[model samples]
Target: MHESKLIIAGGSGFLGQVLARYFKTLGWEVIVFTRSPQANRVAREVQWHGETVSQWTRELEGATAIVNLCGRTVDCRYTTKNREEIMDSRMKPTRTLGEAIARCKNPPSVWLNASTATIYRHTHGPAWNESGEIGATPEAKDEFSVEVARAWEETFNTTATAHTRKVALRTAMVLGDGPNSVFPVLLRLARLGLGGRMGSGRQFVSWIHEADFCRAIEHVIARAEFSGPVNIAAPNPLTNAEMMHLFRGLVGMPFGLPASEWMLEVGAFFLRTETELIIKSRRVVPGRLLASGFQFQFERMPDALRELRMRMTGDVKCTLPLPAI
Candidate 1:
């Protein structure tokens, strides 16, 4: 993949930084598009300040792939302005790239954009696959995510996807060996004896380790057969209660309290975030990826938890090592 330029729209972000390291190792000339003035000097990163798509629309020349990871952090409080920002952050960049591809003389062959499994309904039991139903009407979901997914996919399909071999990654919670993951927050809560399941602990968590996440993207880049929306998550999705139980065992702490749904709602309101982020149950399985013969490094709950804890504490007491993706 050396000098096989891959343009990352939000290359300076948390997941973007992880991808930067991975692609650099694979020898892909990574170009991170950011508005930050200091972003240009950051090794292997280049500045892309244009938001209107007219500027340097031709710069994507000779690119083999374009991975779009741009989006406003959805965990923050979602005010009217914040919601608009969230929608625009994702929709605009996608539209920008789509328009660029439509007009480019030499465009990228592949386009992989970031999406979430949260687009699915809150199902405690019913499982979803790649061929599952995608709701045309926005059901009882928060305003931000409701409109955002529609606009995003619309732009990707109508604009960029038409010109390129596009793949939308409907990713679940991605765990990695860094502070950017939700592991620290959960770990800290457990250490303080405040850790337990959120809400009823019935919601399923479909997760992928950072290594596998990167590997999956690489696979998509190499395979032209994978197009459309692919579920970039682990097949085994444990219930929130079971996941918390594993955390308690790994951290060697007692489960203190289960976060109440009402409390979560109140907190979401206060935090300016959508409570659906906490309460929504997504039991998504990687049917397509598995069918495509993708192998998982850490497929089980206890194993993923144990290794994640060790990486965080810098203390290796167990025999199990980090699983290779």
Candidate 2:
């Protein structure tokens, strides 16, 4: 029997590496398409400048699935140059992949493109499903992010790929133990007694555990009914204050120093990142996945945080080696 091949574009990042390691353990031949191919990387690496068709296009033929996680990290300050790169990075790769898949003799059955949960308007009232309202709110400071997401999905929706089913993964913040992931940073802050609520602390944080994230992707890939925009977040979205309280408890910290909106803005400027990332209320939920009978291993925030904490402290052993980011 021939082995199934999985291609991940921009697979050197935190989420990409997680997916690569998980799929590899499931007996899939994982190939990472990256601009910087390293010999010591976790999976096989293929080089491709994201916007153009190259020799890497051949790998798309006869592949089981192609996951496009290609996008500039939104962790930096949103300058004019950074804004342009951020928008271009997402749209160009999506457009290029569509072209490649269209030309392939045997294109992958499914294409999962990365999108963001920040596309939804800021709301503390109710959780947002796939069909939720999408727009920017001045309070969230997510205008640029919403613009980027809208253009990115628009490009993917307009692209014509006759044989492949496409799914836009409108993912929230993914919690993992990787250095590049948010988990370690938050954990470190908790340990330092700084894991307090930021701004008003009422902003809802939508998140998913790394394990469930991988499982959710696999679930979507196997189910043909899943198409268009799908929310990849846990069902129980908690407030920023609530999440930080959990973190403080997990770390055995009695007190945490809270940062006001102005303090957050000042800190963000020094950190070279935007405050919108932390302040936005992303109350996204996986409606299609749940409606289709997909069960999440780590559904709630407390369970997910405890599991990650245990793994970090060596209380629980991981089955697979950590993938290099």
Candidate 3:
């Protein structure tokens, strides 16, 4: 019997590290392709420039699965240089991976590429599924973000890799205990009584717990029917106001202050981040995942937040058993 192997490109980041640990515990050999290979890494690291093909192409030859999470963090302000870096970081890696897979004698069974739920148009009306409207709204100030998402998917879709099963993971804001994750930032705000609604607070925030995110990825890899653009978000997406309210309650805080649009803009300028990340309405739902009968362990925000709080406080261990694939 051959041992299962999983190769993750750009696996040095937070999400990549999460997947590496999760899959490793499930008895699969994990290989991480990183620009900087550290000796104390969780998985075997292979150095490779994300844009070009090199000796690292050999790692994809007979792997069980390949997950591409290569992209620059979008947490900073969208300056001219940052925009170019963001687009190139995603497009080059996706194109390079596809080219490498085409050269493989035995390509990985499945290729899961990272995408964003922000691809959907900003909406306060109905929730967006896989077939939702994918345009930028002027109010959300998401023109550049939508442009990036469209190009990222287009690069992956146009890549010619017939033998490998491809799936674009339109992942939502994943809540986890990682230092770079959004959960801690929000938790800190809630504790400081600054956890309040921003810009009228009508925008919907779509998110998923880190555990369910891994499970959904496993489901996508195991299920043959899951292909194309699959939304990896929780079914229930609440309003920003509601989410902040929940956060305040979870942290045992009362009387939090609300921030207007101007306030958010000022804060964003100081923080060197964009307000679109907070103000955009991303009511994305996992239509494909749900239709395929995949269940989320943390469907509701309250449950997910409680679990994260427990883990943060050291009341619960982070070791989550992998669901049967």
Candidate 4:
């Protein structure tokens, strides 16, 4: 009998590596379709440009699951070229995977595509859930990012895949143990006494721990009832000020320097990133997951931060070894 297999497209980054290891521990044959072929002991690596359907598509046949985490990082300035690349990087691969899955004689049981919590409008009122309104309002200052997310989900949903269950993962900021990830950056800022509220500081910040994020994906795959866009975030969403305060407390920083809108603009400019990422209010909630009996290990912000802090400080025993790539 053939072994169970999982295909993670663009599984070379921080999240992907952790996911690859998680599935590998379950004794599944893990195949990663990435552009660059790197030496990895745990998973098999296949080379494919994300936009094209190549021989890598063969791996999709009879696969147990396929999680599409493809897309360029939105950690840069939103220049015209950057915007185009950002949109294209997500849309093309999603459509291409759909086509590949359509061609598969034995398609995977589920295809979990990555979306963002930022798809919802910037607001402080109600927490945006799976059924929440998508942000296309002219009032939204960062409508461009929301539009990109809208198009990304649309391409995945519209694709013809009869045999496969499709779920758009509307993910929030994932707090993971990686130097390049947002956690480390925020940790550095906290240590430097720069972990302060940006803009009005009333903006909401939603996030999930890396462990819960992986587990949630697995839960979705197992439960046939979960479909459509599911918000992959913690239940307890907090204001930017509250979040920064918690971070400062965890890192032993008594105070953080608050930044106004103009100050944030200058800082973003210096960092070569956009301020909207930090300033935009994203009060996202995982209503569907809770309704579907998905239990998160890290439900609250303080608990999640504590675990991450311990991991970063080498106080807790590491569960999974860091990926070779």
lDDT of 2 by residue, 2-25 (tens): 998999998999999999999999
After superposition, candidate 1 runs with Cα above 4 Å error: 37-43, 54-58, 136-144, 160-163, 318-325
Clashes of 4: 0
Show how many residue pairs clash in every candidate, following the order shown: 2, 0, 0, 0
Query: Against the true structure, what is each candidate's TM-score?
Result: 0.90, 0.96, 0.96, 0.94
Runs with alpha carbons beyond 4 Å of true place in candidate 4: 136-140, 316-325
The top-ranked prediction according to lDDT is 3
lDDT of each residue in 98-139, candidate 1, tens digit only? 877888888888999888776666566567888665552333
True lDDT of residue 137, candidate 1: 30
Candidate 3: regions farther than 4 A off:
315-325
What does the lDDT come to for candidate 2? 0.91
Once model 3 is optimally superposed onto the true structure by TM-score, how far is the C-alpha of residue 182 displaced, in angstroms? 0.3
Ranking by lDDT: 3, 2, 4, 1
Q: Candidate 2: list runs displaced more than 4 Å.
A: 316-325
Judged by whole-model lDDT over C-alpha atoms, candidate 4 comes out at 0.87
TM-score of 3: 0.96
